[model samples]
Target: MKKLLIMAALIFAAHFAYAQSENIEEIQQFIISDVRYNKADVTPIYLDAKAYISLYRVKDEETIYMANVWPAKRSQSYGYIYDLKQTSVDATDDTYKNETLTFKWSYKNDFDNKQGTATIKLGLVYKPTGIAFLMTMITEDLNVTEFKGYVSGSLNLK
Candidate 1:
């Protein structure tokens, strides 16, 4: 009877562990459609460019990737991957209905080697028939950029 009870407990523990890991495997990608640059001159320029970004959150480790989508002549379009210093997620039970997530990080580009703090906010919403997603990035002493688009999971932006 003792051996049988131990075996049953082990089985239950394994099942619970598997359920927890499934949530952590989710990765979301965002395609930037329009970029609004808020210049220091109080004039904002809107550029309709093709860019890609991704976010992956797992406990103390979160990654943000900004893809370089210019020139169209580079060997690789994948840009820098920054380690986020702070992250916050405010989500509802139905994430597609309404949700918001924010990420903060400091980065230094290889071009000028200047450090700056970057904060990105992701707004997600769901309509009766479709979904809507928007992302905005703000940096210190730099232009604030806004991206209007949706993700591949529910909405398509072209």
Candidate 2:
């Protein structure tokens, strides 16, 4: 009787662990598509070009956030793996039924022997049919040749 009870408990624990892992996989697969940069400029020059950015939630001791931005022209790309400090969603005052998702992310990057810490604010709006996103980055060690206007684009969930 004792062995049977222990076996049942172990089976139940395994099932629960599997279910939690599946949920994490679903969250990791969430994708944002059709993103383009409308305005921006960071050194290496090509970083300013329009691009598509994808976000990923990596499973670590704590969840690790990461993003990959590939230029629309396919010339250059940037990778950001960081900690997502906070996120908030709220209804927007637009006629077209939309909600805004805002995220505050922080990361460290290295460029030409110089390392810098970056704080990025990403705002995404879910439109009636599609989505739109805007991002701004502030860095301590990277030079921004052109940082006027804004980085704006459209996003589609994949």
Candidate 3:
């Protein structure tokens, strides 16, 4: 009976170790795509432009970052920054009380199902009670065709 108990303990420990995934690291440049608001079409917009941009972890377990956008900063196409024309946040302390982030992008095709690609930043804010990542994305796409939507993808956390 003692041998049986010891064997069971060893097995349980091994299984527990395998059940946990690796901890996510401080990513420098993470990219994601497939940002849609509806589930109409599954085609990728900005097929030529890579999304997800770069990321920075200010608080390790919780962080946000951006890099690599469609129209770089000088192209007059698209760009991102800690500050922009749309820093509409309710932040009273001055640091964007976490309102709307400049991480905004969109695509739509009313004539023939406009596909959109948006790269919104995600932040994992560590609070006192628990850890959570929060980020916002703006979507004002009017669905005219079969599927008008928005979607976002993130890097594999582990």
Expressed as tens digits, the lDDT of each residue in 1-158 for candidate 3 is 99999999999988775553233333543233334435443336433443334443334445343333443221112222333234333435434333333454433333345445454544442223332333344444443212111223322245
Deviation from native of the Cα of residue 125 in model 2, angstroms: 0.9
Candidate 2 residue 37 C-alpha distance from true site, Å = 9.8
Candidates in order, TM-scores: namely 0.50, 0.42, 0.26
lDDT of predicted model 1? 0.55
lDDT of each: 0.55, 0.44, 0.39
Cα TM-score of candidate 1: 0.50
| Shift in Å, residue 20, candidate 1 | 26
To one decimal, what is the Cα RMSD in angstroms of model 3 from the true structure? 16.5
- Give every collision pair in model 1: none
- Specify the highest-lDDT model's number: 1
Clashes of each: 0, 0, 18
The TM-score of predicted model 2 comes to 0.42
Candidate 3 regions with alpha-carbon error over 4 angstroms: 1-27, 38-43, 46-48, 55-80, 83-121, 124-136, 139-158
lDDT of 1 at 46: 21
